[model samples]
Target chain A: MDIVCDKRAGGTLLQVNGRMDAVYAPAFEKECLLVIDGGEIKVVVDLTGLEYISSAGLRSILVSAKKAKVKGCSIQFCGVSGMVEEVFKISGLFTLFSIVPTVEEAFAA
Target chain B: MMKPQGIAFRLASLTLLVSTIILAIIVGYNYSVSRKIIVALAEDRGTLLAKSTAKKISTAFMTVQKVIDSVAFSLEDDRLTEKRVNELGQRVLINNPEIFGSAIAFEPFSFQHDNQYYAPYHYRLDGGPIVFARLGSDDYQYFYMDWYQLPRELERPIWTEPYFDKGGGYELMTTYTVPFYRNRDGQKVLQGVVTADISISWVQKLISSLSSREAEYVFLLSRYGTFIAHPNANLVMNETVFTAAESLEYPQLREVGRRMVAGETGVVELNDLPMTGDSFLYFSPLPDQHWSVGFVCSKKEMLAEVSRLNREVATLGGLGFVALALLITFLAKRITHPLRELTVSANDMASGNLEARLPEATTKDEVGELTHSFQAMRESIKNYIENLTETTAAKERIESELRIAHDIQMGILPKLFPAFPEHREFDIYASIEPAKEVGGDLYDFFFVDENNFCFLVGDVSGKGVPAAFFMAVTKTLLKVVAESRLEPGEILAKVNDDLAEDNKSCMFVTLFLAIIDIRTGVVRYASAGHNPPLLLPKNKDAEWIPPLNELVAGIMEGTQYTTKSMTMHPGDTLFIYTDGVTEAMDKMNNLYSEDQLMVVTNQCLGKSAEQLVDSVDKSLKKFTGGAEQSDDITMLAMQYLGKGSKQEGDDRWI
Candidate 1:
């Protein structure tokens, strides 16, 4: 899994790529945790390059979500569709946060 | 040599010490024996010379006295009185040729002389005519000399120590003086003494001729301790033994001189002499004159032959010692070389070179035995490693092939979600996780026809290649029957018959297969010894449908399955799974039973088919907490949306 974190206008743009299964979930968590630890409250995860994800990856995102909320920070996801979108919809995490179609729109939300 | 702790050095040193001690003993013995022999010979020669010289002096004195006695007896009645005394003395000198000089001295006034001293002394110059001198003068006090006074005091003829008679104008001489009487009264009266002068040259000549060796010198010392005749001309008649001992600083010479003067006969060893090396002095006293004859011999010259013998013995012993040392070194090396080779071989083995070879031992010693054992051990190690490597390779090959089979089996399952994307009537998703590299669980879905869709979840009877092969054949048969226009129940029943007809291995698959017509909003489902799916109604909680109680597929030839009909509402969902889901376990061996599945599904209300499956999967992983998955888990979920119904907002990207 490749978690590319970039600085944006309103937050850190974290681009998640590749299969975020149980083997790669910890790396996804660590990338988000580093941004939060650096005092960057607002985060945007770009799923444009993401090819696949599993339940273990979902758990990590859920934990990151709760942490961001408690810290008065917000996390938005952009560029999601197909199997990854269905995974979020089935796990009921689609209603938990703002999901946008593009990086610009995610940070705007 | 390896550590300076070998026996060769010890042997060499031992030989050195033993040979040194033996050589010292032999040399010391030789020295003492040679010294004793030389000293004994010297003492014997000195004693013989001393005795003969004393006898010669005595005989000379006796002959002169006898001649004087005969002359005195002839003159007793005035037969040629003092007129013939001179002629008689001349005759005595000519008769005794060994004497360098002969003299007859007379007492004064009674020998027909008018002077108070009428003594006449006659001595021959070397091989010359006899010279005469008158001793009647006061300066010629021959009447008071030891030659005159000592014999007169004892009333016997005595030989005097040799002395230079300068006043008498004679040679260095020893005088034998005897008294002659004249009848001046009736009682025996004192008359003129008769003296014979014997030159000391003859005795000195005797000493010189005694020995021919240069280091062996003979000398005589007077009773008064003066040197009389010595090889050293400066000491002859000039130095006494006491004075020479002090000047030479050879303290032992004092003892020698004392012994000589005391008429002692012995040999003394003198060490550290000035001009000569160590020497031995042998002395014997001439009692007639109380003089001593001594022979001096150098110790070096005396022991020269013994030293030569010592040198020869040392050379021979040294050669022998060298030979012994070489032999010992060679033998020691011969014994220890094999041990060194063994050490090297052992080191090579420790470094993992089992093929290292030791040289063959021919001696049948313990080293040879060790070599045989080591060879056997090496062979054993080689065989052991070869067997281990072969066994491990076989196991790895089997495991790798199983992994490839697992990949193929997992590939054949339908993994793409929303299986019918153009058909908005339903969304379906499924997944299969095997317990091992290859599993017995399988799930697949496809279009039976244009309007009818088919899907199924199943588990075979066992795990691994056999069950996986069986699962594949069963799955393919079902697809063929579904395409042949058979109902879901008939399709499974036909697949079962086809499978049971030729199946030699007793294998089975528990299947829950379904076909639905999206246009009619109806789902036709069948169960063959499989778990029923949960119907999650649009308005209420989900529930398990009653089982059809049919025989499982691939168990019997004519196993018939029953169908159940259910019309799905626009939002109703169907969740079907194998027993692996219900029987999933945690580390403590706690099972995720049917009750737990329902409890987990309660959180899936309003979720899509994919989300519902993922949520259950998440729950299984969570429940198990990373424990080993011991069974295959297979699940298929489908949500039906009735015709003409659509998502609130939707966009499909090309």
Candidate 2:
């Protein structure tokens, strides 16, 4: 998995690619936590190229979201589609955090 | 024929070579030095002998000259008669035994007028009685003889070359002659000659007696280089030193001969003489006779004693070297003996024999220290192996216990088929395969009342024993809460509150719980962050039952859950599964996504629930193609049949 972080006017944009299964899930969580620890009040995670996710990946997302909530930081996800969209809907993660269709939409929100 | 390859052999051989060279140098040097000293001493002795012999011969000649001089002085008397001359000659002969004869010869008509040759002679034979005779007859003219004529011409006394006197003395002799003069009217005129004769036999005997050693000999040379007395009698008086040198092809001997005749006295080495091999010649001249004496000593005979002594010392040194080589080899072997034994023991240990016997370290040396260290190493290895064996056995026991736990977990899953046999309105089948010996995936079904059947499928956050325990608690709480005959969402809410009360580990389970009303074919279900189930209509395609918006159970307390209802026709089927089904990975790490699940479920629209579950399991296995199941795969399929739709010959439900 690869994660590319970009600084934006409103938040830090983190673009993640490849698998987010049990093996690579921790990398995404670490990227999210790093952006939050760098004093960014908002984080936008772009998973447009993410192809698959496991239950372990969902747990990492939940843990990251909880940590961000405790630190008064907000984390948003964008580019959810296909299997990733189905997983987010089933796990009720759509209700837990703000999700948009693009990085620009996340910044506008 | 293979040479010795041991260090002992090499050490001994090296020592022998070095010592042999050193001993050879010492013995050789000693032999050469002693040889020089012995040769020098022989030369000195020879020189001394030649000088002494020359002095003795000189003294004898001086005595003969004194006698001859006194006789000639008396012959100068003016009134001397032949009788007086004969008396003078006899007196000279009787007084000197070495002289064989004496003669007094006058000038022609000078002594007696009538006779032309006139002389008188007196002599003796081998110390016998003295005999008197006339020395000058017609056949023996004294004036023409070398003894008389040399003194007349030179006007001085002289010794003549040796010759045989036939008529006068009848012996081989050399004469010493002196001239007498008369003072006639103030002019000195030669009157006659007087002589004393010495036999050459007496001189030869004297010269031959001077030699002391067996290989040593002496020779006498005349002033003209003639061999007067020599070891070879044939050469005496016959061959001169130059003729002998020519016959022998010895130029060095000829050189020495020249020096001798020139009255030179010294020692020289004669190396070119074939008869003498190598020799030293000591020559000296007789002072009065002008004769030379030579002493020849062979160098080989001179150094014989020194050579023998050197041979004995070398032999002893050889014997000592042999003994030293043997001693060195024995000492080297003794030192390396323990090392050889250690090699054998180490080989045994290398071949997996930890109990190989080690040689005792008796001495406090390097080999001994190595042996001690080896024994210590062996002991440590043995202890380490023992500890390793014990740890492995403990791990095996834990593995076996996990197998039993897996069995118990499977046993609690309601595995009996044809469950609720008397009720033929629905058919359900479920299976759970853990990725490990135990897993956290579970599926359970139980009737909360005679008209209500509740079923649940759940997956904990992770795998293994902790997840399995959480799964069990969730299943039990769902069963307990369902017994209260509440709605699906109310039951899930109560169970989640009970689970989150002590969930410090933050572990949670995704659960889908539902109750089917067999009388009306109405299904009410709630999902606690679980995957949505696929619904397969008897005559249409498969579609998912949209999931509720709720967090997974055991994450937080007081989390409310909402229930959704669905009406199923007589041949419709519902399939629920954990993410282990859809997220199952192939060797390429590609997931068996929900799209494949939807296609396979549509194909199983008219199949029984058991057939549908088996088809999906086989499809997953085929897609994975021996890839390791990285998660637990739990699947449940239920097909509802309207009331009174039981088929004939399907008495499996009876």
User: Which candidate number would show the highest DockQ if scored against the true structure?
Assistant: 2
- Model 2 chain B poorest ten-residue lDDT run: B645-654
**lDDT of candidate 2 over B290-404, digit per residue (tens):** 7898888777777778889898989999899989977887887887788788989999999999999999999899989999999999999999999999999998998999999
Q: Return the TM-score for candidate 1, rounded to 2 decimals.
A: 0.51
Q: Per-residue lDDT for B211-304 in model 1, tens only? A: 5473467778899889888877789778999999999886788888998999888777788665557877766777767787776777777667
**TM-scores, each model vs. reference:** 0.51, 0.59
Candidate 1 residues lying further than 4 Å off, grouped into runs, are: A1-109, B1-80, B131-133, B180-186, B212-215, B319-654
Candidate 2 chain A: 10-residue stretch with minimal lDDT: A88-97
Best by TM-score: 2
Write down the RMSD of all candidates, one decimal each.
19.1, 8.8
Best by lDDT: 2
